[model samples]
Target: MRRVSAISWSLSVFLLSFFFHLLPLSIWSEPAEPTPAEWPPKFNALLFENSSGKLHVIDFWYDWSRGGSLRITQNQLAKLTYERSWDNGTSYLYPSEIHSPCWLMHIPPGILRPNWMEGAIYHGQQYVDGFLCNVWEKVGVVWYYEDAVTKTPVHWSWIPFPGEQSVHVITFNVGAVLEDVDKWEVPDYCFNNNNKLENDEEMKASAF
Candidate 1:
């Protein structure tokens, strides 16, 4: 009887283990994986406000190309000064006729944000225009951006200046206009800016 009972217990245990092995492996506990390519591509255009009172539009990830060449139009050609090339070698900042509101200053290799465009504008120390019309372009696309910032007279420490020692630093001193951005016209089909790029983005740059 003892032998029989022991044999029965062993067989029961073995059968239980076999049944569990036949069960779907997922019955154990790992997290479900996320679907592939589920996230939609996105872009951003933000006008930031500082402690003082200025406004700034911070843009990230936009495509501006339309054709083999940049799809810039004749109407917008007047806005751009012209395109010129440098030696493409290591160089310094403050190059002549660069004609950009922000530029990458000469920076040594291996530095963070070295020799890259900044999110900045040359504002003012006077009680006047803080934003100025500079230039406009988005990445990965060929089109003209409108440099609509009005110039200001007072200078803020947070504001960016080309060839300044800082990198990617910018300013939006004491003339921030939230109402203006709300009305800016953006292209209706812009994947990033679902609204039209408002001309008013630069309207309040000079207004207090």
Candidate 2:
């Protein structure tokens, strides 16, 4: 009777070990990070920017096919300005308003694509601006957050010298292209200026 009982106990233990080994590995492993969704070829968004306490509202238009981006900004003083970047390694800033004589400088395009975030370190989920977001950090230079459900960008922040600046997407409209083509035309004065303007630190932070 004792010998029979010992054999039964050993069999039970072996069966338990086999069952555990057959369980899926995922049960004990961390979930894989999700890939970020690609931005639409043509889209626009209303952005609220907070740069070390200074605030601005921006109407941002992005057109990958045209290889250009336009940012129309209204600063705290209710003054309007424009900044346009082209793939041709040039950017123009109309400091005062549209049609204003703009300052031209060399600035490469910094638009984000899906693959750009491929190697970014995922930080899991967090709440940002009242929305639950999946966050990723890239090269310790910037933190990007996307809405967990919609996959739309919620916010992004970068550290520039002296401070960190953040931009939040107030509204995003995909497949929305600027109807006014003339809005993208570079003012003649922009090309006429012989001197190139130095890149602003704020502008550098806003890239990407």
Candidate 3:
């Protein structure tokens, strides 16, 4: 009877060890590092932004190959504004109501490439904007979040030298291009001012 009891206990221990070894590696390993999905070459998105306590709703159009990005925004006061940035380091800001003169500036490229977040430091995962996201920080200037399951961007915050701005992506339409070619053309009024922003100054400005 004693020998039988000892054999039973040894068998139980061996069975437990075997079961544990059979478990998936993912169960025991650390969570994998997060990789941000590349932005499509041409896409459109609606963005909600909070910039230094000011709120804005923006209709954003991006065309990487053309090296142009257009942002049409309605501010909290319901005033409409348009901003256009190009790869040649030119940007135009105009108001729809013509209350203010259009402003043009020469600066670095205001748009980033698809692999902008490549090699960014992954800060692990968290719940942001009600979605489970894999977070990453790029060059200590931007915090980017992408949904873990869908791999779509959920939120991103820019911490520049002067202030911080957070942008929430309301909607993203991949492969969607703006059909209106005329929208990419800068208004003639913008060339009137011909202002230029230094590289350092560009850092203080928003880049999307």
**For this target, which candidate reaches the highest TM-score against the unseen true structure?**
2
lDDT of 1 by residue, 1-208 (tens): 9999999999999999999999988888674432111111222222222323322223222111210001111111123211111223221111112222212222234221211223333232222133333332223221111223342111212323321111121332332333333222222222232222123333223121
Candidates sorted on lDDT, descending: 3, 2, 1
**CA lDDT, every prediction?**
0.27, 0.81, 0.84
TM-score of each: 0.23, 0.78, 0.77
Per-residue lDDT tens digits for candidate 2, residues 69-148, read 89988887755778888767777777654344566677554544436667788889999999999999988988999999
Task: For model 1, state the Cα shift of residue 150 in Å.
Answer: 40
* TM-score of predicted structure 1: 0.23
Candidate 1 scores a C-alpha RMSD against the true structure in Å of 18.8
Tell how far residue 67 is off in model 1, in angstroms.
10
Error of 2 at 53 (Å): 2.2
Candidate 3 RMSD computed on C-alpha atoms after optimal superposition onto the true structure: 5.0
Pairs of residues clashing in candidate 2: none
Q: Report the number of backbone clashes for model 2.
A: 0
Model 3: residues with Cα > 4 Å off, grouped in runs:
1-32, 98-100, 196-208
Candidate closer to the true structure by TM-score (higher is better), 1 or 2? 2
